[model samples]
Target: MLDRIANIIVELKAVTKEAKSLARKEILYKDELKKIKLENVALRGQNATIIKERDQAIKERDQAFNNLPLKDNPDNRKVKELLFANKIVCQQRDQALQELSIKREELLKSLQEAKIAKKDRDISLSNLDEVISKLEAYQNICQEVKSKISQGKRVDADLLIEYAERLLFEEELGSTSERKLDYLENSYMFTDQASINRSLLDR
Candidate 1:
């Protein structure tokens, strides 16, 4: 019975160690998600600025075209140069808007992925809490068993030890599951961009 109790304590220690590791990973993933969210927000702001600038450029181009005096027979060369410059500016604005649109789409996709990762992290944390609760319950039972043993009671501490062992095993399983979920979620996020780019390149 003593040997069993010793093994149970060892197993509990291992489970707690794994739980701590999983908690650390959860924090890391949460930080990464925050970074991605910030990047997405910045990209959205940039896209909005690009759109506003494009609209302003279009308005300016229209105004310039309207202000030109066609009947003045002015130096057509100057008019032509102004028109050319306006066209170039308008084209540049259009290109910038187009690029901004593409970037916005990419950022939106990344933001969605980050949200999913955050959800996974939350779930992992919830599981960890449940495991912690179970560990506390098992610890209480072990204390009771130790008191009985001290009183010279022929208590079957084996039952308490076994229960603790089961609880510890469950905790380990939860930690493993959480780790796997985190890994899979992160892997999907990283690979999604690569997969899309590969398909585009192929096309």
Candidate 2:
């Protein structure tokens, strides 16, 4: 009977110990729940203050905006006019730049054309000078030939050699004969010195 009582006492002690542990756990859980509730109340107060400040800031900014001038003010109209004038000036500047570019291109083209024309004129003048020199040499040779024959003088071999390549046109020597240059070169008056002497004496 004593053993049975002791077992019953032990079981009762275990039950009491478990109940105390559960009580301790319940007290800790209640404390944590109270702390969480306090933190939530603090957060709600902070949120309410932030909302009030935001509302006050918005109201002040709106009232300040209402005190400002409207768009129809004189100063605003002047700013608009200045902006329009600036736009017009920019357009005119662009147009002038475009015209300047076109004029520069035209000037360059004209310069190139004038340069080409000048070059052609220079070539033509050189050719005319060469032709004129040849014509003058030919005329001198014909006159020497005529003079030597009429005066009975021996025409030099050098003078005959020069006329080998020279011809007298009707426009140059006023001769109506249709004789070519080589035909005159083979004539008696323009041959060797012996032929020139005989031809001159015969004249």
Candidate 3:
């Protein structure tokens, strides 16, 4: 009977010890569960922050889409503006080239007209030279005639008739007026035509 009681007492002691160990394990498990709950709360806060940021981004994107035209883009508009400007530049350049061509044509025409005018001037100068030559020859013959008359040589009948005819012609021309005297005084100098400008010098 004592041996049976001893075995019963041993078994009861083992059961009590096992109960205490199980109690300690239960406490540890509860602590671990509390930590997990705290971690879950932190994760929930992070998730909320991420969701808030995503919502704000979506709102801004929707606002931008509603404000802008469907087909409008900044880069596309800039390229079109550049193309328009380039077309304007091309037009201006072409207009300038056309104006330059017209100016060149006008310049060429002016050059041709100037060449023609130069030719006319050269012809006029040549005619004036021939007239000067004839006047010089006439002056030399008159000088010879005057010198012979000064030496008391009588002029021929033909010469006398010519002189008479010239005097009669001068009377008909009205140069016998006082204006002839003024003309002789002002223009009978050596600068008249040739070196023998002595016709009106003896006024």
Candidate 4:
């Protein structure tokens, strides 16, 4: 019975360790989602600014073209030259507007992708929250079992701990290690667990 109690304690420790890891991963994912959202907003703003500038350029080009005298006159050469210059300016403005349109389209696509990513992040965060809550509840149950053990109670702590361990494993906490690292690196708010652990150890 003592051996069983010891095993349960060990299993509880492992579950708590995994819970910590999952919490860290959840934080990283949340941070990354925030960054993606911010980038998406910035890109949208840039697209709007580019569109406004393109429209202004088009209006100015049209006004310039309209101001030019296209009809043949006494100063035919000057008129022709002005018309030719106006055409070149209009062409250049049109090209710039086309490029801006293409850029705006690309930004829009990127924003859409970011939105999808944010949704996925939110889902993952929700799952993590659920897992964390379950883990906390299990931790409390383990504490109760410890109290029972201390009081010379005959609770099946071993079976309870084993069930909790299975629950932890069922959550698939280890699967997010790579994803956590990826988001940690890509996220705007930098977080380094190794550095944090080292600092804590140093203290």
- Reference-based TM-score of each model: 0.47, 0.39, 0.39, 0.44
* Cα lDDT tens digits for candidate 3, 1-203: 23443454455455556555655665675566556556555655665565566556556654664577756745576556655655665565556556555655655565566556556655655554444433333344445456655866543433333443454343343444364334333432333343323533443
Backbone clash tally (model 1):
0
Per-residue lDDT for 167 in model 4?
Answer: 53
Arranged by lDDT with the best first, the candidates are 1, 4, 2, 3
For model 1, give the RMSD to the true fold: 20.1
Per-residue CA lDDT of candidate 1, range 1-203, in tens?
A: 44554565566567667756866876786677678667767866876787677668767866766687877545677668667876877687677667767766776776677577667756765665665566555555556556755866544333344445656675363434454334223323322556534533542
Give the Å shift of residue 137 in candidate 1. 0.8
Comparing 2 with 3 on TM-score, the higher-scoring candidate is 2
lDDT of 4 by residue, 15-104 (tens): 666656766766686676567667656765765676576667657755765676766233666558666766766676666557666765
Model 4 alpha-carbon miss at residue 91, Å? 1.6
Best of the candidates, TM-score: 1
Clash number for each model: 0, 0, 0, 0
RMSD of each: 20.1, 51.1, 58.1, 18.3
Residue pairs in clash, model 4: none
Candidate 1 least-lDDT 10 residues: 182-191
In model 2, the runs with Cα more than 4 Å from the true position are 1-83, 152-186, 189-203
